[model samples]
Target: MSLFNIFNVSASGMSAQSVRLNTTASNLANANSVASSAGETYRARQPVFAAEMAKANQGQVGTGVQIKGIVESDKPMLKEYMPDHPMADKEGFIYKPNVNVMEEMANMISASRSYQMNVQVADAAKSMLQQTLRIGKS
Candidate 1:
C-alpha cells in the first residue's frame, strides 16, 4: 500500500469512530429517560461498520471503513411500578430506556481512543510525506 492510502484509511477510521462516539453519547444521555409506554421509550443505538474495498490493479484492496447503518438494541426495557411518577401509565407503571450506562460509557471511551489513534496515524503519514518532499531540496 502507498503512503497516500494511509491517509484515506485513517480518515475513514476517524469518521467511523466519530459516529460510534455520537451514538454512545446519545444512548448515555437517554439512559435515565422515562416514558409512558414502551413505544415511546428510548433504546440503545449502535453504529454498524463494514470494510470498504476498492478495485485496484491487483484485484481488490481494502480502502477503509464505512458506516453501514445504526441499529437499535432489542434488550427489554426496564419497567417499574412507580405510581407517583408523573409519566406513569394507566397501570402506574413507568418505562425506562434499555440503555446501560456502564456499557455506553465504556463504548464511548473506546471510540474516543480509536479516533485519537486514527489522528496519530494521519499525522504520521503527513510528516512522512513532508520529509520525502524535502529529500530532493538543497
Candidate 2:
C-alpha cells in the first residue's frame, strides 16, 4: 500500500474506535438506569464493525473500514429488590440496564487506546510523507 493509504487505514480505525467509545459512553450513562419492565429497560449497546471491502479494494486501493450496525445486548438485566426505590415495581424490584460497568469501563479504555494508536499511525504516516518530500528538495 502507498504511504497515502496509511492515512485512510488509520482514519477508518479512528472511526471504528469512535463508535466503540460512543457505545461505551452510552452503556456507562445507562449503568444506573432502572426500568419498571423489561421492555422499557435500557439494554447495553455495541457497534458492529465490518471490513470496508469496497473502500479497501476499490481500484486496487482498499484500506478503509466501515461500521456495519449497532446491536443491543441480548443479556438479561439485573433485577434488584429495593422497596424504597422510587422506580421499583409492585414487587419492590427494579430492572437495571444489562450493562456491566466494569466491562464497559474496560471497553472504554480499550477504545481510547485504539483511538490513540490510530492517531499515532496517522502522525507517523504524515512524518513519513514529510520526509519523502524532503528527498525531492535535496
Candidate 3:
C-alpha cells in the first residue's frame, strides 16, 4: 500500500477506537443507574466494526475499518431487592443496568491502547514521508 493509504487506515482505526471508548464510558457511567422497570433500565451498547476492503493490483487489501452499527447487549438486567430505595418497585425490587464495571474498564483500556497504536502508525508514516522529501533536498 502507498504511504497516503497508511494515513487513511490509521485514521479510520482511530475513529473506531474513539467510538468504542465513548460507548464504554457511557456504559460505566450508567452502571449504577437504577430503574423500576426493565424497559426503563440502560443496556450496555457495543460497537460493531467491519473491514473496508479495496480491490487493488494485488488480490485485495484492507483500506480501513468501518463501524457497521452499535448493538445493545442481550445480557439480563440485575434485579436487586432494595426496599428502602426510592426507585424500587412495589415488590421492593429495583432493576440495574447490565453493564459490568470491570469489563467496561478493561474495554476502555484496550480502546485507548488501540487508539495510541494508530496514532503511532500515522506518525511513523509521516516521518517516513518527511525523510523521503529530505532526500530530494540533499
Candidate 4:
C-alpha cells in the first residue's frame, strides 16, 4: 500500500474508534438510570465495524474500516425489588440497565488505545513521507 493510503486507513480507523468511544460513554452514563419497566430501561449499545476492501491491481487490499451499525445488547435487564422507590412498578420492582460498569470501562480503555495507535500510525506515515521529501531536497 502507498503511504497516502496509510493516512486514509488510519483516519478511518480513528473515526471508527471515536464512534466506539462515544457509544461506550453513553452506555456508562446511562448505566445507573432506573426504569419502571424493562421496555423503558436503557440498553447498552455497541458499534459494529467492517473492514473496507478495495479491488487493487493485486487481487484485493484492505482500504480502511467502516461502521456497519450500532446494536443493542440482548442481555436481560436487571430487576430489583424496591418497594418504596418512586420508580417502582406495580410489582414493587425497579428495572435497571444491564450495563456492566467494569466491562464498559475496559471497552473505553481499549477504544482509547486503538484511537491513539491510529494517530501514531498516521504520524509515522507523515514522518516517513517527509523524510522521503528531504532525501529529494538533498
Candidate 5:
C-alpha cells in the first residue's frame, strides 16, 4: 500500500458516513408523518455499506467503503384512532410511522462523529505527508 492510499481509504469512509447521516436525517424528518394505511405509511431508511478490495495491493483489501443500497425498516407503523384527523381512515383510525425520534437522533450523532473522526484522520495524514516532503528540502 502506498502513503497516498491512506487518503483514499479515509475519503471512502467519510463518503459512506455522509450517506448514513443523510438517511438518518431523512428518517427523523418523517418520524411524525401519518398515513391512513400501512401502504402509505413512511418507513425508516438506512444505508447499506460495503467495502471494496484493492486487487493490486494484495488479497487483503484497502479501506474502500461503498454504499450498497438504502433499505426500509420492516417494523409496523403505529395505529391510532383520531376521527377528526385529516388522514384518518373510514374507521377513524390513522396510521403513524414507526420511526423513533430518539433513535434517529442518536444515529445522526453517531454518523456525525464518525464523519468528523475521518476528517481528522485525513487531515493528520495530510500533515504528515507535508512534513515528510520537507525532509530533503534546504
Candidate 6:
C-alpha cells in the first residue's frame, strides 16, 4: 500500500464514525418519544459499514470503509401502561421507542474513540510526510 492511502483510510474511518455518532444521537433523542400506536413508534437506527478493498499486485488490499446503509432495529417497542398519559392508546398503554439509553451511550463513546483514533492516524501520516520532505534538506 502507498503512504498516501493512509490518509484515505483514516478519512473513511472518520466519516463512518461520524455517521455512527449521528445515528446514535438520533436514537437517544427519540428514546423517550411516546406513540399511541405501534406503527407510529420510533425504532432505533444503526448504520451499516463495509470494507473497501482494491486489487493489487500481491493481493486485495484494504482501501477504506464505506457506509452500506442505515437499518432500523427490529426489536419490539416498549409498551407502558399510563392511563393518564395524553398519548395513551385505547387500552391505556403507550408505545415508546426501542432505543436503550445505555446502549446508545456506549455506541456514542465507541464512535467518538474511533473518530479520535482516525484523527491520530491522519496526523501521524502527515508528520511522516513532512519528515520525508525534510530528509532531502540534509
TM-score per candidate, in order?
Answer: 0.93, 0.92, 0.94, 0.95, 0.92, 0.94
Candidate 1 global TM-score: 0.93
lDDT comparing candidate 5 with the true structure: 0.87
Global local distance difference test of model 6:
0.92
The predicted structure with the larger TM-score, 5 or 6, is 6
Evaluate model 1: give its lDDT: 0.91
Cα deviation in Å at residue 89, candidate 6? 1.1
Please, what are the lDDT tens digits per residue for candidate 3 over residues 1-138? 689889988999999999999999999999989999899999999999988744443554647888999999999999999999999999999999999999999999999999999999999999999999999999
What is the full ranking by lDDT, best candidate first? 4, 3, 6, 1, 2, 5
Against the hidden true structure, what lDDT does model 2 obtain? 0.90
Worst 10 residues of 5 by lDDT: 53-62
The C-alpha local distance difference test score for the whole of candidate 4 amounts to 0.94
lDDT of each: 0.91, 0.90, 0.93, 0.94, 0.87, 0.92
When 3 and 5 are scored with TM-score, the better candidate is 3
Model 4, total clashes: 0
Expressed as tens digits, the lDDT of each residue in 1-138 for candidate 5 is 666887888998999999999999888889888888989999989899877745435664456787899999999889999999999999999998888899888899999999999899889989988888998684
- Pairs in clash, predicted candidate 6: none
lDDT of 5 at 13: 92
Clashing pairs in 5: none
* lDDT for each residue of candidate 6 in 21-73, tens digit (9 for 90 to 100): 99999999999999999899999999999877443433746478979999999
Instruction: Give me the runs in candidate 6 sitting further than 4 Å from their true place.
Output: 54-60
Question: Better model by lDDT, 1 or 6?
Answer: 6
lDDT of 1 by residue, 11-79 (tens): 999999999999998998888999999999999999999877443435545478889999999999999
How far residue 105's Cα lies from its native spot in candidate 6, in Å, is 0.6
